[model samples]
Target: MRIPSYEDMLAAHERIKPHIRRTPVRTSDYLNDLAGCDLYFKCENFQEPGAFKVRGAANAVFGLDDEQARKGVATHSSGNHASCLSFAAMRRGIPCNVVMPRTAPQAKKDTVARYGGRITECDPSTSSREAAFAKVQAETGGDFVHPYNDPRVIAGQGTCSREFMEQTDGLDMVVAPIGGGGMISGTCLTLSTLAPETKVIAAEPEQADDAYRSFKAGHIIADDAPKTIADGLLVPLKELTWHFVSNHVSEIYTASEQEIIDAMKLSWKHLRIVIEPSCAVPLAVILKNPDAFAGKRVGVVITGGNVDLDKLPWMQT
Candidate 1:
């Protein structure tokens, strides 16, 4: 696969600008004191589709030609990407077919449907999701937009960090939750080019720490259906994402399930925003290792806010 260039990222920003919201960068004095650092939160949760995935989804959807757009796009996502892609397709007035894990949050499924995306549910495993997606693609002939692995998607995700840089000055580091590494890869791509002095850190749930293991192992290490409260982060790193992780990431950190839950609740309390568990991993890691970021100006990417109100993680037994 051809790696997307800095130029591609700039092009993607231009292509997706009109379609996506330039979400606000928010800061909380409470969070800053807790983490022992000045923290700037890029609020992608305020995105139209309620996630940063819309940046990539919109880029991929709008980048397509007339013929490709007619067939539409398809992908497999645990949650956010599916809804975001559906929202992008809806904006383009095209069809979007998504294969989501049967265990995906009801809120995400509802959003996907609300945006006119056709959903095909599969078992909560990478193999099962791929198998289900293959059938959907075969039937519809829609262009396949890999959630994190596609170059177009990564380039699109890069736009987030670009915007973050424009919003904040001299960020010592930027941290983002890593799943298949789409957001992190984008962060790496943007920082490596635009802000080379800034460190790029990836945060993951200890329960689903494939990227962490992969970073330590110096290669790709995938997990199969790893159970984590951060459901959006259960996916493993693909080759495209691994390239960015191995070469550009400053570090990989993991947070326990309880830590992730606490961080999620804390952000909601202080930031007055409902961020999903996946988005809390970065703050969880920061709270876990305060010394690493104590004096730094850190940018934390809040990846999404799509959660089922009836089954909040903290309220679960």
Candidate 2:
């Protein structure tokens, strides 16, 4: 499998600049005190589609030619990518069709519709998602934009770390939540080339820790439908992502569901930001293993903030 290079990432930044937001990098003294590290949060939650997924979606959508754009774009995502791709396609005045799990949050589904994308729901499993997406692609004749697996998407995601490194100086480490490993792959791509001295770490949900297991076992490990509060991290790693993870990542850490919730709440309370559970996994791992992060300048990628307000994980009885 081909991996995206620094040049691709630079091109992606230029390609997506007009379409996506260059989200802010925020810091909180309270959060720094709690973690014993100077934590810089790359707030992708502030993105137009409320997630960093827009970076990749925009690259894929805008890369297409006029004829290809007319047919539109298609993909399967838990939430953020679906909404992001829809938003990107809408910006270009093209059709966007997304295959999403039936169990995806209502707010996410609503966002897709609000962006004028058509949705097809499937069972909350990778196999089901792929099957449903195949039908969507066949019917719509749309360009396939694999959420985290496509080289274009990974290249687009690499732009985040490029921006982060530019926003903050002397970062000892960068951490991000690992789902299908697109964002992590992007981080790896950028940091490996631009900031080789800095280490790259991936955080995962203990309930759905295939990436963790894959990292340890030296191969890919996939789970069908592992349940977790960090719903965005449920997807397994693909070959394109595995290539970057196996080569560039320094470590993979796992955090429990409760830990993720605590971290999510902590970010909202202390940092005054609305981040999703998946976005909190990195902070949860940092909180769980403070010794590893203590006194270091760490950059944490906050992936998204697209959560259903009415059905918060902490509010459920």
Candidate 3:
């Protein structure tokens, strides 16, 4: 797995510029006062396909040669990646085969279908998704577009940070949630190149802190059946992403499920954006450890906004 250089990632930014949305950098005095720091939010929820995954997907799909594009693409995604890839494939007039777990939320499955991607339901376990994706690749001869492990995907994701850095200055730190570590890895890499003085932090749910543990232990750590409201962050980091995180990330922080729920509600109320639990990780971390970020100018990436409206965790009571 060859990691793309900072220059290569910037080139991908140019290639996908027309296809992706330049999500806004929003500031909230309320959050700043609460955390005792100036905060800039990168609202990727307003992005095309409702997540930062679209940037990577679009870059991967369009980067394919004619022969590979004709073969189409396959992947296994929990939600955001599936919809983003499906949307990108649809735009490219290519067939997209997504191997999603049967336990995936109805809204996510519906979103994929809406984008014309064919879904293959499998067990929600990592092993099952991997097996099913391999089968799809063998059967359809489709190029496998990994959710976080692909270099092209990482390069595309890095563009988000590039855009954010170009739009804002004087960020003491950049915080993003870590799942399979794609977004954090890409974000950290871009910051390492573009804003070396700015610290990059990986935020994860305490229940799903594989990245945190792995970074501490200096090896890849796999959680055998993790459970968390941050569904997009259940997966453990893979090799390519681990390398980037270990090298560029300044620290890893964990947030409780309740903290994520609170952050989600706060984002909806204050930012007027409906962010899912996973998207709230950065806020959760900030609220949980205010001292770490106090007196610093921070940038938090609100990664996505997709959620089951009828079953929002806060509405259950």
Candidate 4:
């Protein structure tokens, strides 16, 4: 498989510009005081699909050729990617097939369907999801857009950082929540050229710390069914994503379940945004380790806000 390049990211920016939003960068005095740093929140949750995954999804769907478009695209995701790809395909008047875990939030499932995606439910395991997806892809003969592994997806994801650098000046570091590392990889891709001085850090849930483990071990380590409230980040990193994580990422940090929930609530209370648990990982890490980011101009990617209003993690009975 070919690796995505900086030029590809440039092209992806142009190709997906019309489809995805240049999500705003936000900040909070309270958050800055708490973290002892200037925190610039890239509000990807403001996306129409309520996630940054749409950046890559739109790039892949719209970049597809007529032949590929007719067959459409297929992917297996925990949540955000499925809905975003569905939204993009819908915009292009094409089909999207999603193989999602049955345990994924109902809000995500409903959003995918709302975007006209056909979902095939799978067991909540990397093994099971991939196993089921193989059948779906074979039957549909749709081009596969691996949720975070594809070069197109990574290149597409790189555009976010391009906009991030353009929107803000002199960012010392950028911290984004990592699942399969698409966002992190894209951040690496863009920052390597756009702002080489800026460090790219990854935040992950301790319960699902495969990426952290992989980073520390200098190799990829995957968990088939890791449990975490940050469902969007349950998947393990693939070769494409791992390449960037291993080479470009400066560090990987983890936060506990309660930390994630507390951070999620803090964003809702202060940032006044409805963000999912996955997006809270960055803030959780930043808050937990103030010394690392203190005095730095830190940029945090608020990855998504597609949480189920009825099932807030902190409100669990």
Alpha-carbon RMSD, each predicted model: 0.6, 0.8, 0.9, 0.7
- Tell me how many clashing residue pairs each candidate has: 0, 0, 0, 0
lDDT of 3 by residue, 1-317 (tens): 89878987887898888888999998888888988998899999997688999988988999999999998999999988999999999999999999998877788889999999999999878988898888888999888899999999999999999888878865889999999988987887688888899999989999989899999999999985688888899888998998998889989999998898998888898888888889898999998998999899899998998888878988763
- Per-model TM against the reference: 0.99, 0.99, 0.98, 0.99
For model 2, the stretches where C-alpha displacement exceeds 4 angstroms are none
Task: Mark the 10 consecutive residues where model 3 has the least summed lDDT.
Answer: 308-317
Q: For model 2, where is the 10-residue window of minimal lDDT?
A: 308-317
Comparing 1 and 3 on lDDT, the stronger one: 1
Candidate 1, position 128, lDDT = 97
In model 4, what are the clashing residue pairs, if there are any?
none
In model 1, which range of ten residues has the least summed lDDT? 308-317
What lDDT does candidate 4 reach at residue 148? 93
In angstroms, give how far residue 241 of model 4 lies from its true place.
0.6
- Candidate lDDT values, in order: 0.95, 0.95, 0.90, 0.94
**Which whole-number lDDT from 0 to 100 does residue 65 have in model 1?**
97
